[model samples]
Target: MRVLFSVSSWPTHYSSMVPLGWALQAAGHELRVLCMPSQTAAVAGAGLPPVPVLGGVEVAVHNRLSYVREARAGQWPYPWTPLHPVTGAAMSTLDEFDLGDYLRTDGARFAAASAAGHDTAVEFAREWRPDLVVHDPVSTEGLLAALVAGVPAVLALWGPVGTHEPAPVRILPDDLGDSFPRHGFGPFGPDLIRHVLDPCPAAVAAPVRGQRLPVRYVPYNGPGVPPGRLPRTPGRPRVCVTWSTALSTMTGPHSYALPAIVAALTSLGVETVLTATREDAEALGPVPATVRLLERCPLYALLPDCDAVIHHGGAGSAMTAMVTGTPQLAITFASEQSRLAERIASSGAGRHLPGHIATVETIQAAVAALLQDVAYQRDAAALRRAALDRPSPVDLLPALEKLAAE
Candidate 1:
């Protein structure tokens, strides 16, 4: 069987699918990754064949435009229009506006950006004639190509299911309506997505729609040298601090809280290891002597030795910490992230702090609680076991094979 995988330009989104691609290749199936031209190097680094699409354009262009538009309009970085109290309560107990806002802003923008690659991907799919196409949710081009080619398509989720209230494609702006018909499909709906491969552990995941296939969460932090044997301070707890690589680039420097985070850790006198790219690190003018900063270091390598992790609430960062059984303090600014952070806190494995309220004192308090409390550590261990107990990507081969056969 030939399998084609499509993902967005973001590293976190695409990296989540690498292990599954590897699984298909190992099972004697041919595989090729369809991604933005900018992401070709990253896909290749993961040891998969990359077929770059979207010409030379990058998705970040649209994101930057949206950011500027929001800023100019005096809206939140990524604003959610509040629903009426009566309507909001009627929708569901949890806030549905976040998902609605995501579809309006990020989801719609992503679809527009991805539409640029639609013809290119369809052309590739027609030539390669793969039996199956697996794609992350935002990669609408993948589904379009698969539909055009008359092949089965699986929706692989990065974390928990966030598009449950309204099907993602259904809520897309009308400008995208034409793209669907061009591929011989009507407005996109749940039927177009054959399966949802969920990696989030049940304890922290939102209830999924459609056929749910549970897959173990595997952490792939791009290609990087392992931070060799971190030396621990005797009897002192070590904490890892990371801001997601994409956040700063999307929202700009004003969103950075690492300096405040480090200050809090220093006040508590816990050993702190800060990991970031050179660009992100350079944004921080100077580093204090108390903090050890490593550039381009993989979290999988750094998190195991640390007792707790403080991060911007990115799915990759949260899951990496979870798989390692490290407690977390998630400082989130966006709606999707805030939702995930809430789930993490409720799971007994971590704490969530809204970016607006994450002051130095509060950060310091959260970190100290994670370190001193035995419940957090114990719960984190349980969550780790639950995640590991899920089916491995290779184990899902039979199911995919059956789908392709049908």
Candidate 2:
């Protein structure tokens, strides 16, 4: 079988699909990744062939314009406020909006920006004639390509929210009407999503959707070598601190509280390992010698030895820490992130702090709790076991093959 995977330009999103891609390849099936030019290197680094479709600059411009338009329309909110308190059972406004907007627009802003690429992907799918296409929710182009090619399309969710909720009626964009007529798929809808490969464990998973398929969460933080000269084992309790590479771009410079977080961790006398990009590191300026700063280091490599992790609540970071059995202190600024952080806290595996309220004192207190509390460690280990008990990517191969054959 030939399998094609499509993803957004974001590295984190693409990384989530790598293990599945690897599983397919290992089964002697052919695989290719359809991505923007900017993501080609990341795809190739993972040893997958990249089929570059859209112009990177064009996509980037559209993305920026969307942000600008949303900001101008006052749709952009800072430090997402939850409808219910962190540990509450009530549904959040964010979830309601995301599901409603996603079904209505199918991510209209991004879809519109990548409309041309959607055509290109359809063309590629026709030429390549893959049996199956697997894609993340945001990469609607993959679904379109598969629909046009009469192949099965699988939705690979990066987190808990997407497939769990009841999908609303899909409102296809007028602009995309012409593209679908040739294939006779008049309008896209939730029914078109034949399968949903979810990586979240049942313990933290959202309410069910019929097509949901549980896949074990695998940690892939991109290709990187472990830093040399670091201690084999820390003499003290070691804590890892990190922020998403995309957060600063989306939320502005004010979102970067690495300096304060680092200071707080160091004050607790715990060994601090700060992972960041070169630009983020420079922005951080000088830090105390006690804090170890690593540039673009893979969290999967460093997280195993750490007792606890403090992060911006990215799905990759949260899953990496969870799979490693490391306690977490997630300081989230967005709704989706807050949901994940809340799950961590409620599960007894960690704690959540909203970015707005994540002062130095709160951060220090959370880290101290993660280190000193035995319950956190015990719960983290339990979560790790639950995650491992789920079917792995390779284990899903038979089902995917069956779907493709059908």
Candidate 3:
């Protein structure tokens, strides 16, 4: 089977797809990944064939993320107040923090992005006629491409879907753009996805309301040689503080609280590794002696070696820590990340500091809790064991093939 996978330009979303893409390639299937032009080298780095589609909306993505960060910081809202009645208790899926105008703004943003990417995708898929199109949940363009190409498409999840149990899916829009015409096709729904591949462990999984396949979270930190840096185990409890590279790469690094976090953790006598890009590292100015600044490392390879992980509650980072059996400290800035953090904290395996309110003191205290609490370690181990039980990507091939056949 020829599998064509698509994603938004963000490396974080692309990172989740790598494991499954590699699995498909290993299974004697031909695979090509179509991403925004900016991610071409990254796609190649992951050892996959790259199809750089036209009309890359990277600037739009950057602007949206920047807006979300600013909104979370109370700098300004996304055209409206964020505290809506729907925002009660549930975290935004770490999607772009849309403030209050979530549906219309987000819908329009999706439509615009889809319109930008869909035509090229449709043209290519029409010619390629791939057996399957597995797309990042955000990229409905891929789904339309699949529709026009007469192939099945699956929605690959980075986190749990937003809907609660007994998911009531609505009809998909009649058209995303000129390319995706819904007149001849059957009814579509909000996401327009036929299958969902969920990677979160049951302990933290949101209730799945639709057709979902359980796939193990395989950590892929892009195509990089593992950097060798030993965490000072047996000497002092080694704690890692990190932010999602996507957040930093799209917006700026979390400049406000990072240095303070380093100082407080180092002062607390714990060895800390601040894993960041070289640019972000330089952005931090200087760090304490007790803190090690690793500019680049394969996070999946580095995470298991740590006693605890502290980061911006990205599903990738959080699950990496969880599957490694390391306790976590989640300093969440967005709604989805905040929810993921809350789940980990409630599970006794980690602590959370809302990024909006996260100060140096809160970060220091959360790290202390993650490291000192035996229950955290114990619960982390239990969670890891549970995560291990999910079927691996290779193991899901039979089911996926069946879907493709249908």
Best by lDDT: 1
lDDT of each: 0.76, 0.75, 0.70
What lDDT is reached at residue 125 by model 3?
A: 92
lDDT of 1 by residue, 1-406 (tens): 9999988777787677899999988889999889888888888989999998753224444344333333444544333332222222222222333546756775566566656678788899999999999987767777888889998888887775444633221211232435776666877655566678888887887655668888888899887789899888799889999877767555444458887898899899988999987777777778776689898789999998999999988888999998999999999865456777888899999999988788899999999999999999999999999999988998888888998999
By summed lDDT, the worst window of 10 consecutive residues in model 2 runs over 166-175
lDDT over C-alpha atoms for residue 349 of model 2: 86
Clashes of each: 0, 0, 4
Indicate which candidate wins on TM-score. Answer: 1
The residue-by-residue lDDT of candidate 2 on 358-405, one tens digit each, is 788989998998898899999999999998888899998998999899
User: On a 0 to 100 scale, what is the lDDT of residue 52 in model 1?
Assistant: 83
The reply for model 2, stretches above 4 Å from the true place, is 55-113, 164-191, 207-210, 228-235
Q: Judged by lDDT against the true structure, how good is candidate 2?
A: 0.75
Candidate 1 Cα RMSD after full superposition onto the native fold (Å): 7.0
